[model samples]
Target: MQRVLSCFFALFLGLVPLASADVEVKAPDVLVRDVTNEVLEIVRKDRAIQAGDTQRVFGLVQDKVLPHFNFRRMTMLAVGRDWRNATPEQQGRLVDAFQTLLVRTYSNALTQYRDQVIEFRPVRQTAADTTVQVRTEVRQSGAQPIGIDYTLEKTEKGWKVFDVVVAGVSLVTNYRGSFGDEIRAGGIDGLIRSLEEKNRSLETPQGAK
Candidate 1:
């Protein structure tokens, strides 16, 4: 699961600025397919990212990939019922910390890119539906195909991804157990502090390690 999750970040590579404007009107599946192609092309051509430029990778993710995600909702879901126990300020901190943790932890995936085939399944959704799942599969030679599914909601801004399930494991759910442990040990503030520490520890590039 961890290996698949690590490979998942590679999909975020090479996001171009031009795609931002069209996101609001594009269907969920179309958006995923287009962005995946754009990102893959950029990753293939950028030598810096291929050489493990952590700063550049992190910047691209913050600028391009993050806009497509609803981090606050992701954090809330990951934290489960404990989310309501947090104050507004603490909730904001949790969102920031979780976002940072993800970016820092997976930023190095830019350097690990292999030419894996990505297959997008036909989307099942209607115009009246506000939430939909965009399913995809990653195929690599000698390995079983891994399923990656994006759960998105139609917000005023566009379709924002609130959760990702990789190989049947929900990303938020994967963290929920550890988050619950932290909250039980020290409260919401403790979870924020723990995430901050994890982010800091991951500041160095994975390649460097």
Candidate 2:
């Protein structure tokens, strides 16, 4: 698993320490804690996990992460020029499959959450534009703290996190080029097939190890 993903998971694996649950939730703190808590609450009790109660990890990922993401925009960015050629149905399937792939990836990496702590940096703003960067630090006991920044855009409902940058790498940027290559190699269906194939090989993340 990638360090960025691992670091973020360690900070937000959702298992409330019980003692920490009653404390008042606040921003930077709440942003990191709440999302992690929401993710953990469902997976801890889910029976679908492969082992150590990881079966329902994918569902939990979809429920929590998907609600705050823009799959359509993600797909469009990933598909690049191929987006104009795909039919509405094809576009929909591609979005669904891509979403599944992401969920599975999260499920597989859930166990990477270790005994790490998180600190959210203040929201940075350079302009009045609707988009801004929200940053956080994932702190480890004996290791360096990893910086993870969420790129958020204002939506009709509220702020939605569209992309994540860990270290210097952008999750959306990393996948976008590859997805575009897939479209170029096999067309839209081929990309969809690739996503489905990867999802099939998914290993359920279990235990807290």
Candidate 3:
């Protein structure tokens, strides 16, 4: 699971931009392919990101990739039944914490890129379809290729990614169990604190750690 998550991050390095003028009109598959190539090139040349400058990576992610994700939907899915129980304010906090966790995870993953090749598979969709899965494989030297799939839905703004499946394990599902456990232990606030703490730990300087 850990290996899949790590490799998924390296592949994820490419799917960051929705700010492009034509992205709104592009098909989901094209969007993924084009953005993947575009961002991979950026990562390859950015010395700061290559040198492990997490702040730069974080900013890049915040500015580029985050806009394309449906994070509220992601938090709701991960929280499951507990989502309805959370007050609006609690739900808002949960979304913020969850987004922070992913942003930090992505920052760490961005630094681990090693020229892994991404192969995007054909996406099957119809004009009536509202949701579609974009399948891709990450190929690295001396290792088997890993499958990474993105679940996206067409929205008013554009196509937004709601979940990612790594090696057939859904990212939201992976977190759901742990999130459920935390909610059971201390309620929603407990889960929030737990996520916040995790984010803080990730934020700590390496020298301090």
Candidate 4:
């Protein structure tokens, strides 16, 4: 679990400006390679990030990484079948909580960056396709390579990632079970509270460690 989380942050090593207003079929592939290269440089050179500066890392993630993601879709997917039952306000809260949880989680893992290299695999998609998967591998020293895949969809603005797959484990899939349990145990509000509590812990001095 720790290793997978560590490699997951490997994908955020780059922070380039967004792709064109309308991303092409090959845009996701290019986005992965280009952003990873940029993020590598950021991680490699940023002293604050390397030193585990939570605010700095969080800021970078919010400004650079979050923009490329479709957090609403991600939140809905993780919430599973209960999504339709969630009210508009509840859904909004869920998105915020889920997004915050991911940002903090990835930010912490990002401090473990160590000049890892990413190699993107060929994208298999037709030109007319609206959704596609961008595959890649993370190469690290003294460790086995890990598979990282991004699932992106073409929106009116551009290509945005909805989910990330580490090895064969889907980010949404992994969260769905736990989130479902929370919803069943305490309802949507309960799940929201749980996520909010988790995010609050990450904000504390001890949780930052």
> Which candidate leads in TM-score?
3
Off by over 4 Å in 4: 13-26, 204-209
Give the backbone clash total of model 3: 0
Flag regions of model 3 displaced more than 4 Å: 18-20, 204-209
lDDT of 2 by residue, 1-209 (tens): 26566555444334232233232232323454566656455554444443444555555565555666677787777677788899999999988987777666666666444345656676655545577677777676888878877776766644556667787677777787888888789988888898888888875445435
Candidate 4 backbone collisions, by pair: 13-39, 13-40, 14-38, 14-39
Q: Write the per-residue lDDT of candidate 1 for residues 1-209, one digit (tens) a residue.
A: 66877866766442233566787767888878887887787677888877787887788788877887899999999999999989999999999999998887668766778688888999999889999998988888998988888899999988888888888999999999999999999999899999998888778653443
Minimum summed lDDT over a 10-residue window in model 2 is located at: 15-24
Question: How high is the CA lDDT of each candidate model?
Answer: 0.82, 0.64, 0.87, 0.81
lDDT of 2 at 182: 88
RMSD over all Cα atoms, model 4: 2.6
* Model 2 residue 78 distance off true place after TM-score fit, in angstroms: 2.1
lDDT pick, better of 3 and 4: 3
Clashes by residue pair, model 2: 48-55, 49-54, 49-55
- lDDT score of model 1? 0.82
Clashing pairs in 1: none
TM-score, structure 2 vs. true: 0.75
Error of 3 at 202 (Å): 0.4
